[model samples]
Target chain A: MKAYRLRRGAGRTALYIAVIAVSLMYLLPLFWMVRSSLMSAGEIFLIPPVWIPNPPRWSNYTKALTTIPFGRYFLNTMKIVVFNLLGTVLSSSICAFSFARLRWRGREFFFALLMSGMMLPGAVTLIPTFLGWRAVVPPNSYLPLIVPAWFGGGAFNIFLLRQFMRGIPLSLDEAALVDGASYPRIYAQIILPLSKTPLIVVSLFQFLGVWNDFLGPLIYVNRERFFTLALGLQMFIGYYTAQWELLMAAATIVLVPPVILFLLGQKFFTRGIAISGLKG
Target chain B: MRKEEAYGYLMAAPAILGFFIFTLGPLLASLWLSFTDYSVTNVYKFVGLANYKRLFSGADPFFYKSLGVTLYYVALSVPITIVSSFLMALLLKQKFKGRGLVRVIVTMPSIVPAVAVATIFLWLLNPDIGLFNEILRALHLPTSQFIYSETTVVPTLAMMNIWTMGSTMLIFLAGLENIPEQYYEAADVDGGGPIYKLFHITIPMMSPTIFFNLIMGLINGFQTFTQAYIMTEGGPNNASLFYSVYLYREAFTNQRMAVACALAWVLFVIVLLLTLVVFRTSGWVYYEGDRQ
Candidate 1:
């Protein structure tokens, strides 16, 4: 028994060492990004790479921010993200609640349709969708990026909320129904309140999706005035290819909001991703 | 029942309409447009499969080249991601100090914008003063041009992909958790060694999650665009011209709407067929309470 305990202890020590090593390897690039963001352009390309800037140039952030109308981009992204969050949460929850709680014909068929939607590659519909949108709204508008969210959030978001809703006890809704509460009232009160965790998860996912979305905004918003953070950063890099320090600084700034959101809601973020894997 | 049905339809109307407009409508429109000579200049005429004929007849080698690049990316990245993520998940599944912190660090990369990732990697892989080459030189190893070299471009992109294996790792970690501990305990009693337990028990139980990752990874792999768009732009003789990137260029850059639509349909069919093939061959996937 003593020998077994000793072996188990050694095994744990080895595991810890291994984990620490791998974690450092995983974090190396992010660390370098932060470090590089603080260094001067000349310091960045020094032959013997500087692991840390001696006097971390805080001015790089200012320089980077000034290089582009990053303030405008931030606000633009915020506007889109806020609208996306509202649309995705509201629409997805309603759709999911119907699928999860209500009794109706064709419910299963619709749910199956929702599931199959995941299989359709977004690129497949890119061209005609662009044409369709172009025919309606002029190019360089936020409508294309923001309006889709209101339609039904998205198929994945609906699916996720539906799965979460299925785990809720049907008795809650029935109990509310017994009290003469309407379906919407039950959904607004009982389902919404009880489904807070998954709701937050969906919101966080939407937040990250919209915040980090490049291709959508890239394709839609062409005018410099309407650029989001992703597009702004891309354009900035295009012009300032050699400005490594400012580029890293800009990249870091673009990276911060999502990171903060992740840090604040790490549980929901990780759980949401894991749950997606299980269900998919 | 009538009221409930009404409520269901009312709640579902927006999604159904949205699907019809955004998904189904465009899908059908693209199918129609694929056979026409449409450009954004509003000049369109039915060409009766000319675009597709161009694709198949080798008239556009770039289409085939982009397809090849995508295939290469999918083949390399998916397997690498699966294996590495599983290994990382195995490591992470162990009870360790600061495990949560480690998991967060690993998972953070997936959330970073692809453009930012591309920018950072561009500097890191720079030939002269980059960190990677510096390390290589210190280790007395040969330096690589990485994404800059056509020969090394795909593998380099695959390496970048492997760097962000956190999502896959998390999935695998979740899968590992779902595996009941009793199975391992039983194997232990039977004197099954670590390798024996791994191959015989862990693998079978985790097959479903593995299959899930396989499909998601393949789909994502086929759609790789942002990094190539940002970092290389399919440069150095179009080594990194992904299918989606090529299609984007054709649609927006070249303004060849019909060809791009045709490309979209081809991509759609390929992805659909591949997904179906995986589903058909997924007999090896083992689920709890499922008897094969």
Candidate 2:
């Protein structure tokens, strides 16, 4: 029995060692990012890379901000992201409720059509979508970005929320109806309350999509000042091609907030993904 | 009936309108534009089947080359992702201290914006003075210009994809949880060891999640764009030119909308077929409560 206990202890130790190694591998790049961001450009490319900067240059952060119209881009991204988040949440939840709870004509067909949208490659429609946006909105407006989220731009979020909503009991809706509540009221009160998890998940996805979206901004918003952090960060690579410090510093700033958000909200996000099978 | 119809439309109005204008409208317009010699500057002449013919005939090097590269990426990324994710999932499933934290850390790379992630990785894997090479030098191991090399670029990009395993890991974890503890208990009672339990019970039980991940991964893999756009710009010899990147170059950069559309339709058919294959094969998947 003692020998068996020792064997189990050994197994546990072995497992932990393996995990520690893997974790280090996972974190190495991030460690590198922060370390390199602090070094002078000359020191950054020292033959033996500096693992730690003895005198970390704090100016990289400031230079990164100054190099591009970082403040303007940040504001643009926030504006676009906020509106996109609101639009997606409203559109996806309302549509998801309809698909999941409300009875309708051609419901299955429409549902299937919506699902088919998920299957269509965005590449197929890139040009047409661009031209379509051009036709609808005057060039360089946020309409192209904001309007789609309001419309259910893509069906992934709505479908995910729909699946989540299906698990909600129909009795809630029926009871609300019987009690002289309107469908909208029931949706606003009962369904929305119950849908907090999926709604948060959809909102998070929309936020990430809008916040991180470079392609949309690149295509529609050609003005340098209107660039998102992602596009603005890309400029650091070019403008300060040799300045690893400023670039890394800039990259870190853009990268960190979303990551912090993910870590904090990971549990809810995981629950959403685990349930809906949509994150992939 | 009219009232009910009105309510249904009212409920569905947002999604339908979004779909029609954003997707369906664009899809139809793109299709029409495909039949024309349309550039952003040029008001397009009807050049029916010329672009389509050029694509299949391998007359356009970009079309064929990008298709090949895209296929290569799909082949490399999907399998590597599946195997690595499965292995990592297995490791996480084991009882360990700080398992929760480790899972979260592993999932971190996925949520970080792709552009940012690519930038960090681009620096980390830089040929000179990059940490990856430094480690190799310190250990007296060999390393090369990974991202810069044509031969090595795709595989390295695929390796970076392992970080995006949070979504898959969550699925695998859920699948692992759903696996009844009784199966393991029975295995133990029958003198089964960890290996036996893993092979006989864990895999079969996890097959559904695996299937879901497999299909979704393939679809996502085929549509891979941003990484190619950011990391290599499809090249040191066009080695990393993914189809979507190629399509972008065709339509926007080169103003070859027709050819790009042809390529997109091909991709659509390919993805559809792959999804169908997975669905057809799902019959073999085992479920706990399911009966023949």
True contacts kept of each: 0.72, 0.69
Model 1: how far is B46 from its true place, Å? Answer: 1.2
Off by over 4 Å in 2: A278-280, B2-5, B280-284, B288-290
Q: What is the interface RMSD of candidate 2, in Å?
A: 2.0
Candidate 2: tens digits of C-alpha lDDT, residues B119-208: 888887888867788888899999888989999998898888887777777788877887889999999999999999888999998877
Give each model's whole-structure lDDT: 0.89, 0.82
- Work out candidate 1's RMSD over C-alphas: 1.4
- With a 3 Å backbone cut-off (N, CA, C), the pairs that clash in candidate 2 are none
User: What TM-score does candidate 1 get on C-alpha atoms?
Assistant: 0.98
Error of 1 at B112 (Å): 0.9
The native-contact fraction of candidate 1 is 0.72
Tens-digit lDDT string for candidate 2 (A91-175): 8888888888888888889888888788787877787888777877877798888878888645888888888899998998888
Error of 2 at A119 (Å): 1.8
Clash count (model 1, backbone only): 0
